[model samples]
Target chain A: MEFSSKLLQNAVHEMSQLPGIGKRTALRLVLHLLKQPEERTEHLSNALVKLKSEVNFCKKCHNISDTELCEICASTKRDGTVVCVVEDIRDVMAIENTSQYNGLYHVLGGKISPMEGVGPQDLNITSLVQRVKEGTIKELIFALSSTMEGDTTNFYIYRQLEGTEVATSTIARGISVGDELEYADEVTLGRSILNRVPFESSIKAT
Target chain B: MEFSSKLLQNAVHEMSQLPGIGKRTALRLVLHLLKQPEERTEHLSNALVKLKSEVNFCKKCHNISDTELCEICASTKRDGTVVCVVEDIRDVMAIENTSQYNGLYHVLGGKISPMEGVGPQDLNITSLVQRVKEGTIKELIFALSSTMEGDTTNFYIYRQLEGTEVATSTIARGISVGDELEYADEVTLGRSILNRVPFESSIKAT
Candidate 1:
């Protein structure tokens, strides 16, 4: 798209470089910023700059943090023996929101997607294996999504801990809590049946 | 959503302030930036800040420009007697792409929408009326969208220039160039029929 001003064009071009944002969307967003108070743009730019320069990744879990070790890894209340493995900080946040697990988290940073040229080594897999081998974590729960890439990542990590003391488990696959049983995918329904737990245990957990 | 880091939250919040971006998309974009080289973030932030600080609006037409007068307004080859009144620079670019209009443009900045608390006073209507009253412009083509707000803004400007010598007209409303007539909306089809141009003129123009 033709822009009247070089400055506007530059800003839109930079914005469009983001994933899922096209040139038209970038122009719309940049124009919206121009229509707003100057401080709005300042705040946005300043925040991005500050975050990029100052934010830290936890040395222990690789989660985004304000310090060397993230809060969950450093907290005394969270169970260090059980570590929930996730794709990124977003997953960490999602699991934290459910209030279901009080275990610590290990951020894989990304999945093993060969189609995108992202292999096991491209993520934080080595550090995770090192942590598990250190004998601190007793159980490793696979909380990645149910995509093929997610499964490959899980199996890769599970194989890495072949002779280790850490027990490996995956999050349940089933119909959603409020979804109709008929609408469940065949693979998920079959897995749910095969992995069925005791009725009393499910009742107690609920 | 809960964030593991305060800096991450602040950055996401600022990113989400842009129009049409929500918290999830903001987080995704921010995370994508984090995953990219630090220079990517630096470039994006710097471009936005530079654009906000240094961008200028053409003094004559209010179109975004690097100089006091935009290229269209400064060009002597263009017809100063005819000005196309539009909502903003986007419309100006759209019209310029058509390569049909060789006249100057007067940007209104926005439309008259009471629901959004935007009235004629909030727009660039006053200077436009003053420009027409100066007796330089002979005709104004209303190139604003055909929305209710666009029509209201057009009528508002038309009333403001009541005693002026300028003749006013609107862009045509009809089936798009390649659109099937059977699928055309009733309002636009009826208007196209009522304002039909001579078959000979249409053939010659095509």
Candidate 2:
């Protein structure tokens, strides 16, 4: 779109460079900023710049953190011996929200997607192997999504920890608690049947 | 959502404040930025700050500009006597894209929407009246949307120009060029029929 001002056009161009945002959307966002108080724009820009430049990643888990170690890694209350492996910080946040697992986390940053040119070396796999070799972790839970890339990443890590004495397992895939079995996808339903839990164990949750 | 870093949380919160963006999308965008090179984030932030702080509006038409007068207003090729009144800069860009009209524009900034607590005084209506009073404009075309607020704004401006020598007109509302008559809304179809142009006049354009 033709913008009257070069500054406005530049802002829109930069905004549209973001994933999922188009030129029209960028224009709308820029115009919205233009209509608001100058401080709002200043706050947004400053926040983005600060987040990019000064943000720190946890040395232990590779998750976003303000300190050298993330909160979960530093917390003595959490089960440091049990580590939940995830693709990114969002997965860490999602699992944290559930409050179901109390283990420490290992963020791989991303899965092993060959089609996307992302290999095992591209991720935080080397550090994860180092963590396992240190012999502190007892159980390594594979909590990545049930996709080919996720499975590949899990296997790659499992191979790296071959000589280590850590127990490795994946999170169970089954029908959601409230979802109707009939409405479930065929693959999920089939998997749930094949990986059926013990009757007494399922009953104890209720 | 709980973020390990306060900086990440602040950036996500600010990003979510933009129209049509939600918390999840905001997180996705923030994480995408975090994964990219630092220069991308710096470019986006710097451009936004520059645009917000340095952008200017045309003195005559009130459209966004880098100078006192906008390109359209300063151009000798465009019809200075005929002015198109629009809601905002987007409309100016939309009309410019069509390349159908060679006239100047006057941006109203926004329509008079009582539901949103926006009134005539809140807009650039006063400057529009001042433009009309200067007696250079011979025709004023209302190109705002076909909403109730748009009609209200047009009528309000028309009333303001009651004693002026300029002729006023609204852009026609009808079936779009490629739209089927069967699918056209009743009001639009009825209006199109009522304000039907002569067959020869319509045929001449093709």
What RMSD does each model have against the real structure?
1.8, 1.5
Q: Give the Å error, residue B31, model 1.
A: 0.6
Off by over 4 Å in 1: B180-183
Model 1, B24-79: lDDT tens digits are 99999999999999999999999999999898999889999998999899999999
Candidate 2 off by > 4 Å? none
A42 in model 1: Cα distance from truth in Å? 0.5
Candidate 2 local Cα displacement, residue A59, angstroms: 1.2
Tell me the deviation in Å of residue B135 in model 1. Answer: 2.5
**Model 1: CAPRI class:** high
**Candidate 2 chain A vs. true chain A: TM-score?**
0.96
DockQ measured for candidate 2: 0.89
Predicted candidate 2 versus true structure: per-residue lDDT over B40-103, tens digit per residue: 9999999998988888999898899999898899999999899999999999999999888998
Q: Single out the weakest 10-residue window by summed lDDT for candidate 2 chain A.
A: A149-158
